[model samples]
Target chain A: MSFLEVRDLSVRLKGGGPLLRNVSLTVAAGEVRGLVGESGAGKSMIGKAILGILPRSVEISSGAIVLDGTDLLTLPPAMRRQRVGATCALIPQDPLTALNPSRRIGPQITDRLVDILGWKRAEAEARARALLHEVQIADPDRVLRQYPHELSGGMRQRILIASAFAAEPRLIVADEPTTALDVTVQKQILKLIAGLQARHGTALLFVTHDLGVVSKVCQSLSVLYSGKVVEDTDVARFFAGPAHPYSAALLAATPKYTDPTAGLNPVPEAVIAAVRAEVENG
Target chain B: MTLVRTLLLRLMTTAVTLFGVAVIVFFVIRVVPGNPVAMMLPPGATAEDVARLTALYGLDKSIPQQFVIWGAGVLHGDFGTSITLRQPVLALVLGRLPATLELSVLALVMAVLMGGAAALTGTRLRETRVEGGIDVANGMALSVPDFLWGLVLILVFGVLLPVFQISGRVTPSLHLPFVTNFYLVESLVRLRFDLTRDLLAHMFLPAFALAIPLAAIIGQLLKQSLKETMHLDYVTLARTQGYSEARVIWREALPNAILPTLTLVGVQFTFLIGGTVIIERLFSYEGLGNMAIDAVINRDLPLIQGIVILFAVIFTGVNLVVDLTYAALNPRLRHG
Candidate 1:
């Protein structure tokens, strides 16, 4: 059964225009699904919708965000937050800025547990320490006392990963979590997230632009374009042959390391025009 | 270097600043085309009488020579005698210092409370009509100067309602039990509610008049900072963690947002203290600022110089405290 389902969900700029157009996707428990798209494709918006942290400039205009058995859009604000908090967490992009600079790492991680879940301080600290270890951070005890600026980018990302998993939420939204890290650190972080997702048996809504990352970690994939889901399929067959022309172009556009002599193939303007027309027409 | 070293460095800088203020104020007031001795002289007095008075006060000496003599007296804790008051400038300035401090500190506290409330309200209700109203209100407060605010406050609270003590520091007729001029603090410490109430009643209008525009300034800066902080990635991460909007704002966003606002408050405080000149005179309160206006009218060079030096000291002193506070709030500085 799907642990979280977004059905015909539409988000619009307040009294303006649609930001997300009838978008829908799902993640079953223990399944890792990559949300693939270019910039402004509403990939991260889906993750934000699930987590209910969309910017104030936009509002969820229609449809249902069903987490477990409940439709979150129908619930009151407080109840919805409580439900989301109990079941979902986000591994945000930009690790440096994702940790509060003024606060210590320990409280930033333990806060969700202690404040929201009413977990005892000691219990939350213990969980945080263990989660840090799970995320491959060393000297968890020392790290907890340190400020965000005191740590490196990789270390900060690890701390953020640890924070996201502190509550052991059923669903984790990785919103381009490795985008701001060094190239070397990116692989390690990706590996750590994939391992943690497997070990915890958590449903993962992994949002990213990199198809290579999806090839490594995701079981299923959703290809997005202009707030619409162009294609949704299992990762293996989708990689083997993307059903949509835009998806094929996106794949082709990604530089292949296997053939370094082959130059980068930019996504064709013809393909983009057709996709834009199709999405706008709908 | 250690904190001690840093503190010693700041103190040295402070001393240099005070010395600069002393030199500048003493020389500038002399060059203002007014003779202190002439101001002191009775009408129809001869040039010989004026010359005698000038020589007696050491004002007849060369300007630079007079500065050296005054600087020496300052080193020995003698700020020279006030020509107008015929008393030690140090004693007179010191006598008025606490009254100014008490008023300034009370006004500062009020501003912080009012500004904090305004900022929190605006931030909580951002992009709404209420936030827009607060911004407009803040602009209104900022556009009007403190003296205008003082007059408006007096007209509304003092004359119209007739509820508060509009002028003076306390009920002068009552036998005061205060050992210090810090009546507000001393009375509260002594559990003297009646004295405290009476003092606050007198201080309330003046302090609030000073506070309104200051509070508005702080509110606008802090609200803008808070709005920016709310958009940062950490704040978004905080929201994703399932924390309530209040917790995300108060706990996560506020700490980061308050840093810049705190610095502004610190710098604004120096200006706030300087602002007491017009405020104190308008209120008829006995403060250094009120004394400063009197000295300037009489061209009492020593008294004016003394007041200016004291103002400089307070400004630099507040800036030092702010730097230390900024360090405490920012962990990066604290650990580094």
Candidate 2:
């Protein structure tokens, strides 16, 4: 069985429209699956629903988030939390806002282990220090004592990544983790995440708008648009050529280093309309 | 080092602020058509007698000269003597200050507890009917002023049920070992639960009246803050840690949420202190507010000046404490 399988999931606002439309995806152990889409494509919602952190505004209408052979939807809320917490974690979008500014870095990273895992404070702290070291953070002791505001954006993201990996979680949903960093810092963070995933052999559901990032790190790619998965293909198959016209338009839209002049092509209106109609039809 | 500098700077600003309040009060009071000397004299008193009394109290001098003399006296820890009471103005104000302080403290505690509970309840039950109910309650509580609430409380707790002492700080008949003016603190320290209960019986109505609006303000602001903080990324991250919603709200969201509320409460508290005058009068409570009213009615210039200055000192002191507290609660401020 896949390490993480989201089967026929659907989510909608409490009294409003749908946010995710019958989404389904899987990530086998030690694999990276890039969920790529535009801003409002509900790429993040899939991750949120799987992790049971959907906002109060939205509710999962029908979904089964099967993590490590257990269907989370079938479990009670407390048990679902326990199951998810034990096996899965998230690396969020904005590093600056993701670490509570009022808190010290040490406690923010160590809290999951202490609170959810019921580890001793000493053990958690030691683990946090080692995790920080593994993330290539210099002077882990001083960094631990510092507040989020004291660290740079890159530094905060690194801490978050380290925190996500600290518990040895089997699956981590990287929700556009590098989107908030500088272009230079983004490469370093991406490399670090990919390196850690390889070393830990954890399944990763990488959510991003950057197809270039997918080509670099993802083994497989799923192109999502307007709360629906439009295309799902392996990295080689996806890059060598895409079968879906929407996927082709999306790849064309991403600026390439080899063909800089062809870079800024807006995804064709025809393709978006056709795909949007297809989504509405079902 | 920054904190010391901040306090020293705050103290300097406070001195300047008090001087400004003194100047305004001295000149403004003199501008008012009434003369304390005329007010003091009986109906049969002659003009010569008024002049003599005015000169005796140094009210015959120019307003600035009078201020300099009063200011010098104040610098020497003397606020002259009250024209109406025939006592040192400084002594009277100090004597009445602690009662107001104790009442204000009780009101603040009550506000925080009641308001915090309402805010937490509203935040926890957001998008639900309960949250809407809390919002409505907060609005109702805030719309009415404290003195009006005092009257309502008196009507309910005093006149109708008559369960609490609605007029005084403690029972008149209770033989009390009163070492300090802080009856509440002293009673608790002495383990005088009976005395404490009696004092609370008297204090409860007035304190609750004062707290109701402040509680509403706190509830509204804190709940709004909590809602905003709930949408913040850190809170979402906290939830993804597999902690319960309550745990996330309390630990992750509340600290940030409480900051704005603290600022509002700090500013509102000074207004609360100033508000005590009408409240004290409504309840016939022995506080500085009651004295302030009497001082104003009698045109007791020296006493009024003294009371206003004391009020100014308390205001500045509360602001200082608030700033220090903000620093302590916020890690950026503490470490920076």
Candidate 3:
């Protein structure tokens, strides 16, 4: 079995139509798998489902999110909570809002470490300092005492990364972790995440709309369209030549910085319609 | 040092606010068409007697001069004397001050505890029939004013059940050992649990009456703020971190949500003090509100001004505390 496998996962509003339909994907140990799609293509929903943090309105209708051969969907709630931060962590998007504004940076990072890992305060503080250093933050002590608003965006994202990795979980679901950051900070953050994953041998499910980001950090890519995974392939093949029609259209639509005069190609309505029909048929 | 600086600044602001209120109250009382001298004089008294009474009370001076004299005396903690009550205004106000303070404080405590619990429950049970029921009840409570609440309490608990005392701080015949503070505290300090019980029994109806409206206001504010805060990104982050629903609500959402409610709490407290007028009169509770009304009826200018100034001081002091609390609760506001 893979390190984390989501099989036939489906999510829908409590009394409404499906928001995610029969999506399946896997990330092997130490591998970084990217889930790339447009804004409403259910990319984040899959991540939320894995962490079991979907909004009250939405529920997983049919699915087994098996992490390390355990079906998380069937686990009791208390056990599920135990498994979430200890085995699986999420590096959320929008660092400004993701951390509690009223809390100091130190406690926000150390709370999960103490709560999930059952570490003593002294041990957690030591580990937190080390995590901050690992995330390349200088002056960890000063950063620890500061509130979220006191830090710059890059600093906040870095602190969030430290927090996500604090428990040394086996899998980290990074949902557009660098999307809100500037290009320079984005590259640094992506590199930091990759370096941390490599050092920890932690698997990652990286969700984003930016294909360039996927190319830089992801090893394999899953192309989603209208609540379905249209293509799941290695990163090299996805960039060199896509297998699915929707994937091909998505690749075509991406603006290449190397080819400045290559005008952006918007995905045609016909391609979207064809993909939707294919998804609905089976 | 910063906290101290912030406190000092707040104190300065409070001083300026009290001064402004004193000026307004002094002039406003003077402008009201009445003569304290006429009220004090007997029916058969001549013009000479009226003039002598006016000079005696310093009403013969210019308005600003009278204010300066009153203001100076106020700085020395002297509120002159009530013309009708035949006592120092300061002494009368202070005598009734503890009762008002006790009632107001108890009512405020009850409001916060009940409102906070109701809000927490409402948010947790949101979108359910229970929440809907709570919303209806809160609406009904808010619709009725505190005086009406007092009357209703008197009718139900006092007249019908007859379980609790309807009026007064304590039974007239039962005077316990009096210490400096209100009866409850004095009783507690003296280890007089019997008197404490009696005092509490007498206090229950009036305090509950004053609390219902304030509680409704606070609960509504808390519920709305908590709902909005629960939708914030940090709440989701807290959930993802495996914090339980209760923890997320109390730890993650509450600090942020409660900041807005602090201002409302302060304003509501001042409202409660103002509300004590009708509540005290209806219940025959000897509080500052009752005295202020009596002063108004008798056209007691010194007494009226003293009570207004005291209310303004309490109002300003409450606002200052609220501002400091806001700074303490929210780190963003702390430094700025």
DockQ order, best first, reads 1, 2, 3
Model 1 in CAPRI terms: which quality?
high
lDDT value, residue B192 of candidate 3? 90
- What's model 2's lDDT at A114? 89
Residue A180's lDDT within candidate 3 is 94
True contacts kept of 3: 0.69
**Against the true two-chain complex, what DockQ does each candidate achieve?**
0.81, 0.79, 0.72
lDDT of 2 by residue, A64-157 (tens): 8888888899999989988888888999999989999888999999988988899999999999999999999999999999999989999999
Candidate 3 per-residue lDDT over residues B153-219, each given as its tens digit: 9999998999998878887797666957488888998899988888888888899999998899889
What candidate 2 keeps of the native contacts, as a fraction, is 0.77
What is candidate 1's lDDT per residue for A114-139, written digit by digit as tens?
Answer: 88899999999999999988887779
Error of 3 at B323 (Å): 0.9
Cα lDDT of all candidates, in order?
0.90, 0.92, 0.90
Q: List where candidate 3 sits over 4 angstroms from the true fold.
A: B1-13, B31-34, B40-42, B46-48, B60-65
Report lDDT (Cα) of residue B311, candidate 3.
87
Task: Identify the candidate with maximal DockQ.
Answer: 1
Q: Write the per-residue lDDT of candidate 2 for residues B52-152, one digit (tens) a residue.
A: 98889998888889888888888999899998889999889998998999999999999999999999989989989999999999999988999999999
The TM-scores, one per candidate, come to 0.96, 0.96, 0.95
Q: True contacts preserved, each candidate?
A: 0.82, 0.77, 0.69
Off by over 4 Å in 2: A261-266
